[model samples]
Target chain A: MTRDSTPGSLRVLVAKVGLDGHDRGVKVVARLLRDAGIEVIYTGLFQTPETVAAAAVDEDVDVVGLSMLSGAHMTLAPLVVKAIRDRGSDIPVVLGGIVPSQDVEELAAGGIAAVLGPGAPADQVVEVVRKVAASRS
Target chain B: MIPRHNGGVNSPRQQWQKAFDESRLREGPFQTLSGIPLEPVYGPDDGEYPGQYPYARGPYASMYRSKLWTMRMFAGFGTAIDTNRRFKEIIKAGGDGLSTAFDMPTLLGLDSDDPMALGEVGRCGVAIDTLADMRDLFADIDLGRITTSMTINSPAAVMLAMFVAQAETAGVPRANLGGTLQNDILKEYQAQKEFVFPPRQSMRLVRDTVAFTAAEMPRWHSISISGYHIREAGSTAAEELAFTLANGFAYVELARQAGLPVDSFAPRLSFFFNAHIDFFEEIAKYRAARRIWARWLKDRYGATSERSMQLRFHTQTAGVSLTAQQPEVNIVRTAIEALAGVLGGTQSLHTNSMDEALALPTEKAARIALRTQQVIAYETNVAHVADPLGGSHFVEALTDEMERRAEEIFAKIDEMGRGSILEGCITGIEENWFQGRIADSAYELEQNFNRGERIVVGVNRFLEGNDDDDLAILKITNEDEAKQKQRLSKVRSDRNDAAVRDALDRLAKDAVDSEVNLMPALIDASLAYVTVGEMMNTMAGVFGRHVEVPTI
Candidate 1:
């Protein structure tokens, strides 16, 4: 309830899609956004794109951040983005993990609003999320 | 105690002392990165010495002098044929053993051709759908001579069945087949979320595999109780040690409850740990693990054999510690972590390649990672002596602290289950207790790094220009995925469909009875050329799937 007090708190849904179990980055980002006075909902590991997109609509979050370390991003990112689109929510989806540099353009083309690779600072991530959420709003 | 002074013009220590008086160090007392306090110097009375019942010193009397730790780089990617060629190359490069990293599909018990496995077939690791792939995986390599370690958990039993079937077809007796299965399903719930079945049912499969290996595959390590993934998932060293040992204890209890003698199967049990960047902390954690495991096995479990009390573990340099910013610095980070593992007495070590933070290791990077171990083994004198830092007051104190914290954690976990480890772990997992703790630690660390209180060299502290263009990363193409699909299709068509169906039916029938150990049926299915996915699907029908309780 306290999260609603801050103006433009930018409710964000952090989702882990596919069988990739690496959630350290996503959990860290969730805490970071929550600390920055943003409303955060974390969908725990092993989530399907359908489930993630449905949760985004049901929760009506302003933004969605998807984290995956397994190279299933190409296959999974599109599904989640399309699912959110099909649900008629223009929520910006941010991606993070150990993504290769070459895959950046392709992932961005697949509707990833921002791509944060490994070692991206928390402040930079927050700034990107805030900027994207503002644009969406 | 007074500082020692040498009667020279000026000793290096004396110069530093004078400079400290003239200038200043940090504002106050110095501590380890993990917040362990540091005294100016160390002497006796820190803790017990290495060797003996609680083996803080080392597992064996002659640690590396008798035999150096096996250099087993975790390598697998693309199709089985591709990985098999890499295996031969590694053997030719003088690797002592093999460590297999299966692809996401194979790891999660999905066929290569499954719709869920699109674009993930040969990306992370090698794709092995059936016995035919396993046959190609170890094609030219002699199974009797080279011991292999597989990093698979949920479907470990099926993979082991396939391995056994492959070896049998190759005329290698089960007695001669030696390898380790990372069959640590508990950690799957705790940290690495690659699990399929529910917790209690997953325990059944783990128990069945451990029981079967204790009897039939005596030479094989039934399960490698892994703390590596736990630490990588952002647990502190103490949590990693305590949680891993608790899981180990639970497995031991489960096996004993299944009517197996402790000593008979305990010796075959092994451990796997992560060598994080905290050099002294990692060393102390390993030492404390050995001592705690030895004492627990002896006193708690009433183990008389020394072999049963010894804790043998494989170590891998922490991939989480690697940086994508200045990838070259990862080489130094991995070497330091590898050194810590060696000093801490790992039975085998896998140093991560520098490029792993970006992509799967390129051949040159993997080779350099292997050479890092060779340099440590031959050039460095650290291996000549066992527990070389055994008597250091700092190390001993840290080791004692680690053991103390682990005991506290054990007490909490025990309390959770009403003194039953198996029950407590199940409750702890279901309650998201472990996940909560790890998330807290990870969040704290991230906050520290973000605030510049904790510094990662290339990432936060030292700024460097862009120069990663020359770094060649290994890429798996759509062709690789298509080839793997074709291979799986061929295996499906080549095998006798009726025989495979019958074997799977028998497996499904046997799986319902708690009294039946499922390994024999699994092996039968494997021999009948039942795919890994088919075997797991039959069991999943009985066991059901695992859905995690959200923590954050």
Candidate 2:
């Protein structure tokens, strides 16, 4: 709504990438981003990679922030990445919430930008989104 | 004696006191967890004689001396038969009541063979897809004698019907049946994302149960207006209390609309709450919740009876507080939390097993969890008195503070309009409110622990290693799914197909129409061996799905 036409800042999508409903952190991050003047599209709970990817292409979002607390990060993240890549969007994707430190490297190897775990504050999320958005530009 | 006497108009000190009238300043967030200002110290007269409402000084005068709270340990995993074995084990361990947890598929009213239930059958809990599985869930467990509480909601009516049908077949009369159904669907909209029907239709089913129970299952709770899932969904104690009670009112409103007398159903209404690790905060939350509900039921709703005002509740220890790191530490956390629930006056409780963070509780871990409760009941004198922290200045103030803050949330929900809370919940605002508070508290605690200001034994101080030895976890048997599927298929093929079709058709009609209680129809369908999945599939087609847009 604002005159700022920045792509990443314009369309931010928040998703619970898998089965986990522990959205406390995700909700907080969404609020912080919204307050920071970003458009947030939330894709509810229990979203598989296909639905999430289709949504990414549909919404034309600049980033896909997948939240996983179910320890299914490995199984879900790669599928989402592959689906996004197959869509040929070249969208920069970021992950958050309860993905373990070890899986961060693994997810990065598979082309997920990064996975933010617990204690990563709202400010840090905004910073990462801004950086990812700027780099995309 | 040089006693400092007051000087008024001219004295500098007196002028400073007058500067209170002249003082030009305003400040910030006025509530504290303990309801205290930044007052460095406390003395005699801050607050006292803060009598508990709804008989809070103790619900009943004699308290535990007259009645001990029911030891209701929660259990469910693998197949219904497997869970039944655990139920027997729990009963043998002196569990006074039963609380069964259904698996994801069962909770969502899906059969084990449904595509969505593929690998998830009996994953989080026991699978109960039909009357056969429900029968197996309570095969030897005496339902007539012991009270049972099912944690399944969306398909609760179907499950209850199956339970009742099984019981009657076992020669247990419907009149003698006793238990509670956690039928609070509002929490489903916000916290637990498990609802087959839309909110309005869900309330209708709940109303039917409320009405049905008043006639048939007199001892059964029509609904346990729950704050547990809200807390688990990252709401604070106050938010949980407020939102949960707001939901209670919403249900009462629907029941009233359904033409049931307020007192007829209000007496059967119960509540479920979560007792987290914040010792005093949890206690105050409970005490405050009782007071608030009692007041709202009488003053706000114009209910006349004492039973209508009383807020009876069951509690479960916090499952979210457990850490996969040094999982044994969870036992201590559960103990303290269980004590909080006890001290707070929970009518019944479900303590989490230590290994629940990783997998379902192993039999050994479940036994230990039950033993933790046993120790509190028999060894520790914590339960010997009721409302032990009732009159403490800090506790009382906290109760008041929680009450005040919760009222604000309730007001906000009301302002958004009753139906609007569900949509508001979908929007990031309400979740943001919940997440903001939790995030702030969690961050403060993390920062404190990291800075060595607040010690958390193993994590930040007195660091230890190798907690695996402390856990003897119950592993899930892969055979559970196959066994459940086999039994479910038999029920599907062996029943009166015409009856099931008729019931499902009627349920669809009621759902399509204006708000209609679908419980009776649902029960009828269950009687005809309509699988949980089949029933939900009917509704899912009509109501459509609600997407809880991600928050942060």
Candidate 3:
């Protein structure tokens, strides 16, 4: 997808990808990215992987950010990555929330561009997304 | 000036002030996180005694002197059997009460084998699809002898029905079984988002449970109006107090509207709060909460009984405050928060495990968390005094400030509903008023931490030599989900389909009328082995599912 908005500005899609209703983290991240000059689209709670992938493709965003706090990150994140890939798109996905350190390597090797755990600082989150978006672009 | 002396020697206050003026103080805002200003030292203040009306000092005259707060650790994972083993361990390890955590699928009223329940069954808590699971959950445990608190809402009525049926089958009379049901559905919309039906329909369900429990089970606490999720969702301490008490009032109105006497059901209502990391502010919040609840129950709701006016609550150390980085430091954080809960006079408490920020607490972590509470209760000598911080000038001032701010919020909500707290809560949930305020507070706190104005020990300021890679966390494998599916399938196949259909039909028909109490029908359904999903679906078919008006 070509740059649809400002030439250098990145568009990131943040979402809550499971039955977990804890959206405080995702909503805060959306604001942080927005304040950092990134155009962001947030898919609210109870979103399935298929729905999130379809939204990412439909919005034509530079990156997809999935927030899974319900310990379903291991199972749901991979499905989301595969769903995005099967949709004929290679939008890099960044995973965040209460993911254990042991699962970080597996998630990265399973097509996730970045994995941010709980207490990840705003700068780290923003820089990770920018780096991934730049690499994909 | 002839050796001016306020007293025989220099007065203690004057001497302290002289020393304080000479000592160089650090640059500071010198206020609580909730923005209440604090004084370096407190003076005498005339405060009410413990066990009085309004109960500002403490709810009971003796407080912990009479009995220590129950160390109710919230335990659940994998399946009912897995959680049952944990419950047995807790009871053996000096725990007096059991608190159950349901998995995401069970919490949302979905069967384990449902497509929507994929990857979620038995992950966060125990998965209960039928009364069989409930019975297995308490297999060797005696229901009449021990009390269990189930942290399940939205589908709480069904869970209660299953519990009642399980107890009766085990030869325990319904009246003898004691426990608490977290039937506070209003907060689900405002913060937790685990709701199934719309606001009005959910209130009807809550009303039904209140009426049912009041008439039958005298030992059961009908609704535990909660603010823990609200605070965890990122509200200020005052918002948690205001919103939770407002919700308590709404439940009272619902019960009164159902033609039940205020004293009959009001005494059974309880509360749950979050004891956050702010030491003095959390204590002040708890104090203010009791005062507000007692006064509102007596003056606003017109309750004559003291039991009806008393605001008894369970406190859980804040889960959101734990950090994944430097996980061990969370023990210290939990200790401080638990102390605040104790000093604030909570009836029961749950401390967060050190590794909770990363995953569901492992066995060792949960045991240490329980030990933290034990040390406070046994070693600290904090329990010897009731409302230990009662007369401190700073604490008294903060308590007043919390009450003032909460009353302002209540006034706004009252205006929104034109007087009824129940209607006000419905309006607040509908318009996303509560959601927006909570989100704003969460954003501000994040921004503060991001800018280095706030110092989180591991995350922001002290970022050296912290390694969590070696920390062994609990991993819920997919095997549990597969096994849970098999159990659910077997139950579905073995149960009489005709009987299940009949029970569900009766529940659906009874649920259509607002005046009808659905608990009896729910108990009948549980006896017939109708699954949670079947009962919820039957009711949802009548009430329809609630989709939130998204607020970002």
Candidate 4:
């Protein structure tokens, strides 16, 4: 839990929203972010949007990264973003998983800051997290 | 200067060492995923013959030459009607067997209309809330003719009860119903995380199901001991083999403690494995799994029948290997993995779709995935020979090493539970031992890929433009959810509420008594049109919900 000297040393909440149990990608991303000197609060599997929004605000994370492999991303992602906004927090939301490219615009329209699909390397993810957290700061 | 390595007449080991030294191959070590060093050649004693008592070459003597493996394409998404259409389409597309994939809600023992199931209804796979949904899922397919494999855990008995009740209504004899239920719950706590109850209570439920199925459905597989999800969760092939077979042994021990003979139920046990991109390693895993299971079943459990000792399995091409960047390349990956499965002598196979990394496969992608297997069976001529690479030095050595590594893992697990695989797995799950190992392995794999030690064609090395948009991903909309909800609501309104309540009460009572099997009550509840949530909640009253202790 040591804080790095970097200004953009982001504190992010990585969560698995809804009943989708696939967490290998989410766990990997969390490790990569931690390795990149970021603080990550991972709400384990089978969390709801309400719990996620509350955790994001309570943990005071700079960003929320929602990872879903079950195609329920379309349904789960928006609810998470709306829940965050409903909590009166403008913290940026970044989405990752087996998201098809065609749905990127729709997810963006729902207030997602960025969409990272499978094979997005750890460096690229760290870059995205840094940029998103910097914007919030 | 090179010591005439190529032209050497020395012993194979000395010649190999000379070439190894001369070539300066010491720059880096070459090892398998399980950390076994690669050897130059293997001797005759490296492995045993196929169909022997402790079969290492394969489970069967004849293998695919006698009959080709069953192409059981795992397909299900949307409502039962939607999946029924897909089922008919697959059967028409040369698929011999059907593997059902239930939606997340169904997997977790929730009705489609539950609040927890709001956005997930009919999304990942088909949603079955009541007996009607099961009836609709098997609409055109004959239960007596086509062998169906249902991939569901936690709520497996509820689904099995529904399938049985549906069969009764459809006039199919109970003895004629044949298929596999992915009732392996230990792995859920270990890797998959789709569990509903705690380990001890969950084992009791699984025991009831196994005991009931063994007594009633002679043709049905009580459980498909699975390593596929373990591999997908990022374990090495050796870990997958060790953990899965260890779970199988736990189930056997549980059944034996319940007074069921090992032979009566062991023959009905099947296995499921993942066919990853590591070609030779994957083949060796299957070979090792058979040998290990055979020896443990015969020597440890005291099983006399050869049928009880044989380890038959179903293989699915690794979904974790598919990349979203160049989705089309997944076709090649799947073909290679599927070939490995065939060469490994899988009893049945499932080929993952090309677009899986992006979304649930589109119709075309699913067809192409099935065709991948068809081509291997028809054109490659790989199936004509049994254990085709059985005698290869690399494969035999790898197979032996795989068995040895798995045995080490088993011993460690045994130590954790005071020399009991069943108790050890439960403790392992509670302590997060299995999850920790899987997380470490997954992290290592990703780190290797990121550091350039491992190369995934589209993901790491091949710098291709983003072709992701070209894929036509299957999208389940809000209407689909609404439609499924409406259907569930109608069933709720139409069914006899009092009958449902009574049946559920009886189920809860049966679930409480450890000696009493809950199958009969489950069947009654299913026939009463009680939803999955209703039945699971009834049992949950007796056995509380499982809360996982975080290992992260």
- TM-score of each candidate? 0.91, 0.79, 0.92, 0.92
Quote the TM-score that chain A achieves in each candidate: 0.92, 0.88, 0.92, 0.92
What lDDT tens digits, residue by residue, belong to model 1 across residues B208-262? 8888888788789999999999999999999999999999999988888888889
Worst 10 residues of 3 chain B by lDDT: B39-48
State each model's C-alpha RMSD to the native. 9.2, 11.3, 8.7, 9.2
Candidate 3 lDDT, A1-137, residue by residue in tens: 11113345788888887799998998888888888888878887788999999999998889999988999988899999999999999999999998988898999888999999899989999999999999995
lDDT of 3 by residue, B194-302 (tens): 9898889988999999998999999999999999999999999999999999999999998899899899999999999999999999999999998999999899989
**What are the DockQ scores of the candidates, in order?**
0.47, 0.18, 0.46, 0.47
Off by over 4 Å in 2: A1-14, A17-20, A28-42, A53-137, B1-53, B418-474, B477-479, B510-516, B542-544
Pitting candidate 1 against candidate 2, the one with the higher TM-score is: 1
**Runs off by more than 4 Å, candidate 1:** A1-8, B1-51, B466-469
Clashing pairs in model 4?
Answer: none
Q: Write one digit per residue (lDDT tens) for candidate 2, span B1-552.
A: 332424434433333234333433333222244544432111223221112245444344334544568888888888877788889988887888998887777887778997556556786788888777788888877788899998878777777777777888888987789999888876776677676676665655676778778878888887988889888777768878887887888777777777877888898888899988889999889888888888888877778877887788888999877665577888999999999888887888888988665556778878888888888876765654446676687998999999999888877766666444444333323344544555455444444544568555454455458343344545454477788888877877888888888988987897787456666677777777788888888877777755543433
User: Which docking category, incorrect, acceptable, medium or high, applies to candidate 2?
Assistant: incorrect
Put the candidates in DockQ order, highest first.
4, 1, 3, 2
Task: Specify the CAPRI tier of model 4.
Answer: acceptable
Number of clashing pairs, model 2? 9
**Model 2's interface RMSD:** 5.2
lDDT to native, each model = 0.86, 0.72, 0.89, 0.87
